[model samples]
Target: MNLIKRLAGLLAVAASCSAVAAPLLSEGFNDVAALPADGWAFINNSSPPGSTGWFQGNPAFFAAADGPAGSYVAANFNNAAFGGAVSNWLLTPELLLVNGESLNFSLRLLGEGLLDRVEVYVSSAGASTNVGADFSLLAAFESPAGTGWLDRRLALSGLAAPASGRYAFRYVVDDTSLNGNYVGIDSVSVNAIPEPGTVALVFLGALALVAPRRLRQSRGLWLLAGGLAAGTAAAQAGPDGLMRFPHVQVVSQPAAPAAPGPGGFMAYKDPVTGQLTGPNPEQAALLTAAARAPTPLLRQTPPAPRPAHGGISLMLDERQARYAVVRKAPDGSVHESCEPAPGGLK
Candidate 1:
């Protein structure tokens, strides 16, 4: 009988240890300048071209008391230049959600007498640059004319099991009219919930420890004890004998193409290949004008005569002047190239 009580106490301790929740992902938007870094992506789908887009920063117009001091993601839907129509999306990094997990986030509304709506979504389909059609609606909320933040939690355990082991969150906002207010989001987190089997194990263990000795000797109690122990072991081992949790990896995107140079020279290279591409249409006209302008020389003396093969040399020099390096092929053929420079520029 003493041995039975000791075993039950051991099981109860194990159950309590296994019931502790683990954090999967947490982000506070503390670094405003690097808002969408670490796999986060912001997408703007506003029509008429001039609508404001989502950005990360402290509230500019109306402040929310709960907003952190550092920074928060926000969108200005009421800009007059764009006619108050705003459609934007913020996506989370790819995560792996095991059974019994929950997502929590906070939202705040800025300004007075303006309405804004936000919808949360989860996708198990695949990594997408744009918000595709495949996603499950998690929750939706409309912020009344106010200046405070609200915390929200969603039980993701109820969602269908994912075959791919990858999931993401999408925050969609639409503030078509009455754009005086903005929306802010911060303190996003994903955490694990204790599995049901763990809870059952704890309850059964306590009952076995306190129940009369005659009850423990009953056949039905013995069967229930065996089942609970098996269930607890199965839960602990997981499906493939490995415990899993959602994890976020930081993925950096390629930098955008450089704009036209101040002197109207098109010195940008292709992002994939290091080959120099054509000029921007807006800057191509400027290039033509600059080409026609008279060259200015510090010294008035006539330039030295060029070599007979100077044309190729001049082209090579021009490529070098634009920070492109020349590489020689294995066959000894000189190839002009504009490789990606240090500090993420090409």
Candidate 2:
């Protein structure tokens, strides 16, 4: 009975641990030179054109006044050389947002420029490029000049959550007066919110762990708790009944060709098309023999233009283009044709 209670306690703990949601996306701009890569895009929409748009790695653009000495993406309109009006956008990669997910990032502002405004937009219909057409504003604010770095967190539940497709964050800055003040952003992240059901299950599991020993001893209670735990565990397993971890899979290179066959020819099967290619004399002889067999001959469609050297060429027949083979005759006349090329062709 004590062992049973311990087992239940362990199960409850495991259930609770597994209920925590994982981060969907995280990015920290430690290397300014590597910016705008890995799906991050920057666009300049300023009209009358000479505005110096967003710039990264500028020593002036730091996340915090006295914090880490690293780079952050920044936009400034105050000292614009091509000054008339400035509109710039920094976009994040497509991100998947669920009902209870949230977005967070760190921002820093410098100078007393009140004319500059920063707005954050989100889109589900398409890329968050257009302001009024595709993306809807999520939040907007004027950077309070001299405010060092500030952490911002926004709840995304029920906001532009689509069944499929992507969500992009469009950060826009507009300065009609060329205030020259700077707005910097860093350490952006998106995280999922654990579902209520998961929380309830975790709570129930915890409660089961603290139940009176007498209650734990009851066979019915044990069966009920065990069944629930099993169901939860099964739900988390992949289709093949194995636990699934979210991680990138590395594709391995193709395997080397098979050893030479008895006829000194090597064969390899295409992983994608499932077609087999071989230089085996035995297989070639068999194909040649089969071509000479007394099978009824049918008219073959003219072959398509030959491909460039080392390129794939398809040969079609009246019925269909099933296979392609290059045949060499006793007289050294080489012919390429579709599968089962008419039994005899001089």
Q: Give the winner by TM-score.
A: 2
Q: Give me the runs in candidate 1 sitting further than 4 Å from their true place.
A: 1-14, 49-52, 59-68, 78-81, 157-160, 163-177, 194-346
TM-score (C-alpha) between model 2 and the true structure: 0.51
Instruction: Please give the lDDT score at residue 48 for candidate 2.
Output: 50
lDDT (Cα atoms) of all candidates against the true structure: 0.54, 0.53
Off by over 4 Å in 2: 1-10, 14-21, 61-67, 78-81, 126-132, 159-178, 198-346
TM-score of each: 0.50, 0.51
Per-candidate clashes, comma-separated? 1, 3
lDDT (Cα, 0-100) at 146 in candidate 2 = 57
Query: Candidate 2 residues 96-208, lDDT tens each?
Result: 65565567777665646443445565556544444335554555445435556667665564544333323333322333454446677777877774543464466456656
Error at 190, model 1, angstroms = 0.8
- The 10 consecutive residues of candidate 2 with the worst lDDT sum are 257-266
